[model samples]
Target: MYGKAAICLTFVILFLVSCSIYIGTVDLRSYFFPLLQSPPVLRSLCATGRPLRVYMYDLPRKFHVGMLDRRSSEEAAPVTMENLPPWPSSSGIKRQHSVEYWLMASLLYDGQDEDEREAVRVSDPEKADAFFVPFFSSLSFNTHGHNMTDPETEIDRQLQVELLEFLQQSKDYQRSGGRDHVIPMTHPNAFRFLREQLNASILIVVDFGRYPKTMSSLRKDVVAPYVHVVDSFTDDDPLDPYESRATLLFFRGNTVRKDEGKIRVKLAKILAGSDDVHYEKSVATPKNIKMSTEGMRSSKFCLHPAGDTPSSCRLFDAIVSHCVPVIVSDKIELPYEDEIDYTEFSIFFSMKEALEPGYLVNHLRQFPKSRWVQMWKLLKNISRHYEFQYPPKKEDAVNMLWRQIKHKLPGVQLAVHRSRRLKVPDWWRRKR
Candidate 1:
């Protein structure tokens, strides 16, 4: 039986399909960004040339922080939140690619030494260019979105309702209807319950997998990184990556998944026990985390197949481990694509090309040793963009995310101005 959320989503899909006729008639891009034809020039508001002034809403702890609550020692199987060697623990979730942790960290970062930057967080909403709603939507979903059989058990519905009601009642939201607001929905299912209500706003997401293709566009959203979970193959580690690696290719993760992830089972059948190729199932338990990291570090290439969603943390892990990533997902949308050229350091294979007998392995083998080394070195250099840091460093993931958000300011501004001029009826606004 489908839950209410799923039923609502189905209705949304139908509504979007019917509305496509009207949407096609208008140039939607121009409606959102009037300055699309020309380059968007950034005018500095303060002495520092910060283009985007962000005002972060002080949401109650229950929305973001409360869900990460650890069990007390008196309770069974208590878990303490601690900063581990590779992945931080403040935002909960064991994986470094935790969108909840990363998104919150980015906005919360006060900056290194407080000087100048492209995106600056302002305490006053009156002085802000963009408003940030740091609700940790991804974490909320993960913690409460289970039990599809019961709608009451899902915390997302209530949280989304509260979030929308709060925002809608705000003076800022009333002015522009959240067009200039930024909300991180990095996980595919994050805020899925109220996606339509939030669609016009600036969204920070991983990919467009959850939305219908026609409705989801890169023009309105920022693609952000997965918090990488693997420990970096640093100089302190005794093993030399080039010499210690004996496996040509390795991948260990959920072999059984739905949607595009069906490819994993097929690939497993094709590559299992092949010479120098190691493919196995792995549970991401604490013990397995160590094993997975070691496996990737000891392999020349790591396979990145599409999961239920097009993107996965495995690709980021491979980058930090200095393993050349073999991407098999045709629909995968990467983060920071404009800033970083993935083709330089990673190998790509269309699903069709990868499935052609012996094609994938042979193509990877054709790369010369020197070329492979070049890719590995480049991965090491660019891997910093995928790293989330506290007090965000100059070139780290937090800074990179803000840069992406900065790119969206022109469009957001135009959208807000357009919406103000249109002045849709209150009934229509509530309906939407």
Candidate 2:
């Protein structure tokens, strides 16, 4: 009887020990498992702590920094990290389209710290996730011909021709048929001569107002913010921000424009004779830009009407100025939409609502002071994301753009793979 009791007691002890071990593992897993498996959004944003590997083509300086100084292009040697020229201060409004320059500079950066970088230069084309064609097409258009009608425009056309020939000869470009190639044509008319030929590649553009849906769309292309021309409003803190800003609404830029921008002419007429509003006809010049800086700093809302395209640099300028932006574009596609919520900091009006005789001003006149202050605070918080600079800071414009490019890679790979084995033409395109 004692032996039987001893065996039963041993069995009971063994069962309790096994149960304790199982419970301990569950408790540990509850705390530790979440650390190992991060959320999808976090994983996408962090990129598993790896910088995007990019392979940039060794193109001639004439296509990029050389445009800043003709002498650089005349040299036989290509542009190097040590010899890259600074963008000319006299570049004027062209500075807005300088996204291409900053992006190239980001790849050239050879800092000792790699943990904070969003992209790294890779020498081997085989290891590159995406290929960068560092042709400053926007600078080419701005430099070779300010006026498209001028005979000098032929120079821009010839450069596009030469670039196509160079790209077609490359085995890397041929392998993906240019699908993985990144080309910046932020200016609407950049690469005008041969844009259709590069429809397969990834385009970095400011807007799709001019592009056909077939050539460029959000599915494949990346929309980058224009480099803000106005100086950042560094000391924007105020005890009563809404009360400190005297002007109710402000707008100062070209009144005459094309397509959707015609609304500016109509708005100018309606906003005329208002005591609190400061709508004026002006062009972008050194003096005017400085005046605009002061005007935006003291205004409750900065108006951003569509320019030649659905968006313009003015919106980004407003952001940096810490002025609440009143956006009036109907079909604008903003940069970093997946990650940034524009509505948090900006007010939007449909073209119809903006054009109404008294709807816009009346709405602003009644906009809650508390809400405007909230938006102003948010604007200041997110403004750094729009800034473009060298040795790019964390979460700055250049790094944000690289993150955007990484997001598009999965879609890029899918299209590239489908094309390789497809025996028939794309059925989706045929139906369209």
Candidate 3:
């Protein structure tokens, strides 16, 4: 019998195949900042003016087909997100190389094309500022039904060890001259590979911080620092603009897991009686909170009641999309609370105080779009700090790995995985 996780993964595959949830098509002219034809200009990147190249490598094995982000062919209009000035430097480096966002590359498990394999297996001893590894999965290596302690059978633990040790010991690996960084998802497997290839480099993890138990467990083994990008980062007083609508966006994970639908409905009634705060679309219950990141960004405000306690990504996504996060969960003990003011960045409604009839909406009505727009900019800047860098926000990842180049140890010898293997199998084998 498959465990709950395996069953869940199966469900995700089936549902995404059958149900098909999408944010909509992205046209290159608008969605992304740098136009494909032109080098995306960044005015505020480091003073060095070095273009950050992100190479996105493949998607997670389970959701590869359903994921729209991985389809490099899915074109979108140029994005205005990264406001940058065009460089006068030579066109070869500037125009030729696009940021190597890992999202663009095909997942190693997606296909067997030689080109794809080469792209996934590229050596980091040479060019490239960072090898992008978006969507980190540290605990995903549990495999089929077996766990860390389960009896081993057919597969070679060496492969597994390489991946896990890479994440653990290879915090100092560097590649591509002195400028580029070797980056991968925040998994024990990939991290191990990074360790084997690059050591002492910054190992960054970006994702929701809902899995406290799992995260707490992983933290003990952590060899590098990790950061998360929440869908919404709400403050104690989550205020909304007067003219803007008052509504919370949430894609369901499991409605049965909690009364998510009813919770949203109750909030809806409060906003409905008020002016201009009409709720649209029945409350959406997604199997994954990750799906709602973009949805929350599109909506005026996102509903963050914390699914079964203080588990919500609304706060991070809200700030990322320039939306407000209306948090209804009071059980959360957010990280870095002492450093950042939650009340200033996010709006919170205590579970006890939330359903007090019009209390939630009334507070939301107080926020104005103009004010939100300003707050949004502030949030975006703050988001950069929270945003889990594939290459890390600073130069530390590469620097961490770079320091190991002189190490006499075997871990950071800079031996790249040079063998050309099947693409889909590469991804699956790593996941296992």
Candidate 4:
């Protein structure tokens, strides 16, 4: 009896230490502890103040592996360091449309960094905080699904069907119902088939325009900035943006688009003949980008009206050029909102306000020289946060994305716990 009593006391002491450790960081006693019967059979905690462990799914060749082969053959050539935009000195080589590339690089290459050590890939799914489905969904869709009129010819649908089957069979996916899974859907048309089916999963999309509130929002999804294509202004370019910028407002892109994008056509008509605003239709070719770069650098405010989606790469380009972005989209979402405030750097105008004749330009002109200069300086400083670099940097787009995913852990934990008791419908229980 004395031996058993001593053992009980030891166990009590260890439990108290563990609870104290947990309380130091998060007061999860009222939040996560009560819901858990054991030490979370579904989620294995990271032992306090550690970067969350993420498991990258080893999918079949056709789904993600084959994508590298396909794009390497024809889509576009790899962007070398010579062509890369001016990034921070710490930044290494990076691709132009690098969302797919940087994600794969980070997952495959174990860099010499403490943060990278935190996100070590585990083969065991049971020990992971999140499951990363590294499907080059954007690359796959852009190659096979984009501009296809026939739904039957779409190859992404077949891949999605297979992916759904594979995920449903996994015990880990069954436990959380994909709430802990992270899938990149940066392209507007990515995951064309059964998007609603995978809505429970965390989607890394460029915007919420394609997804409804039931499946995606600021709550469950991440809004990633598009991979910028334009070259940035170097330190040798200009000392003063105001002195160098001759044009008041400049825009060069398609004028016609669906939904909120139609405002572009109206604004083009309104701003036409205004000497300060240079509005012209431009294509996304190599030569046109050179022309666009010149225009952006020479302009004070770069016009960023909505395209097919709520957000576009133009805003990022404007930032790299040290040009203040005059945004007109009301529903557009940006990345890293928790850390960086958009109002401090960029200007936002409602569709109603932008459509009004001369109101948009007049409002921009009303800002004093000091205010415009301050906003331009802020824009240049925040440009690094929007960039994706190889091996990942401290606060680059890749690191910020991981940080955002970390912020969702509490909410994901609650959802997983609630789901353990909540009865899901029969329709949501099917494998196919």
For candidate 1, write residues 1-432 as lDDT tens digits: 569889999999878866885767545544664453221222112223554678878776667655556331222322112321123354333354355555555555553454434466677989998888868787677777455656644677888899999999999987887888888887777787788888878888877878786655788788886777777776523335565678888999998887988999899877865788898988677677779889998888999999888888888889888899999987888887755668888899999887777888887767687788777777777777777765457667776777777777787788777767767779898999
RMSD in angstroms, all models?
13.1, 9.7, 21.5, 10.9
User: Candidate 1 — worst ten consecutive residues by lDDT sum?
Assistant: 37-46
Candidate 1 pairs with clashing backbones: 96-227, 97-227
Give lDDT per model, in order. 0.73, 0.88, 0.38, 0.74
Write the number of the candidate with greater lDDT, choosing between 1 and 3.
Answer: 1
Model 1 scores what on Cα lDDT?
A: 0.73
Give model 4's clash tally: 0
Kindly list the per-residue Cα lDDT of model 4 for residues 250-310, writing each as its tens digit: 9988788888888888998899999988999876776778788899989999999998888
In lDDT terms, which candidate is top? 2
Model 1 spans with C-alpha error above 4 angstroms: 1-48, 70-97, 115-118, 150-152, 236-243, 424-432
Candidate 2: segments with Cα more than 4 A from true spot? 1-48, 423-432
Query: Mind giving the per-residue lDDT tens digits that candidate 2 earns over 1-432?
Result: 999999999999989878977877435544664565432112234444688899999887788887888865465565666766777887788999999999999898886367887888999999999999999999899888877688889999999999999999999998899999999999989998899999989999999988988789999899999999999988888899999999999999998999999999999999988999999999999999999999999999999999999999999999999989999987999998877768878899999999888899999999999999988988887888899987678778998888899888888999989888865557867997
TM-score of 2: 0.87
Q: How displaced is residue 129 in candidate 1, in Å?
A: 1.3
TM-score of each: 0.79, 0.87, 0.38, 0.79
Worst 10 contiguous positions by lDDT, candidate 4: 39-48
Q: Rank the candidates by lDDT, best first.
A: 2, 4, 1, 3
